[model samples]
Target: MKTKDKIMIFFLTIITFGTIWIYWNSKKKNNKKNELSRSEKISFDINDLILFLGDINNIQNVENTHKKVKIYIKDSNLVKTEEIQKLKGISSTLVSSEYVNIIVGNVAEFLKEELSRKMEK
Candidate 1:
């Protein structure tokens, strides 16, 4: 082939590969964004309870109480009785003191609820 023709072919090949790479990268970024959104939803769902745990940092313990699971936070003193009562209405029960223990019977319940909402669309 002529030098000019070979050079043109090479440039075209490079452009094609570059376009494919860009498209793939964009798709990956979108997937990551979707995953991040889902993660944020889960985090937001538990944010209030986490904050109510008080100044103490970190989750101390988690226990299964029958079908319910209890999460004990390091500092429970920050939790208010009214807030605990509201939480109990949402799930099985919520107990808070110097350390907070929240009982959620089914962790998957939130995910299931979210999934069903999505499926409705």
Candidate 2:
């Protein structure tokens, strides 16, 4: 084979390998992200609760304004309201469609502030 043809083949091989490497690395990262998100679906801490409050999807609706944050879950059947109620001044109410709405008092403003600050960053 000609020198030019060999060099072209070598470049093509390198490009193909580079593309495959990048694709595999990105796939691994996506899996990790998925796992992390799944593990973070339900959090019982101050920080995670704040992040959950910032998410509009996790919230079904809001009634009465105050420091309380309301969270409605579709998997309420599997969730224990007692555990959720144990969080400081939180209260839980069972709603329709396997949904449970949890009310957490005296922390809405704090969560919003933290969410906004994080968004700016």
- Candidates in order have lDDT scores of 0.51, 0.50
Model 2, CA-based lDDT: 0.50
Candidate 1 per-residue lDDT, tens place, 56-108, comes to: 24455444433344555555555554664465324535564533344444443
lDDT of 1: 0.51
**How many steric overlaps are in each model, in order?**
1, 0
TM-score, prediction 2: 0.33
For candidate 1, the per-residue lDDT at 20 reads 100
Instruction: Report the lDDT tens digits of candidate 2 across residue range 15-114.
Output: 9999999999998887764321111122346554434344334444433235344344444344444555566555654444534445544445444444
> What range of 10 consecutive residues in model 1 has the weakest lDDT sum?
35-44
The superposed Cα distance between candidate 2 and the true structure at residue 37, in angstroms, equals 32
Model 1 quality (TM-score): 0.37
Q: What TM-score fits each model?
A: 0.37, 0.33
Alpha-carbon runs more than 4 Å astray in model 2: 1-44, 47-64, 91-95, 111-121
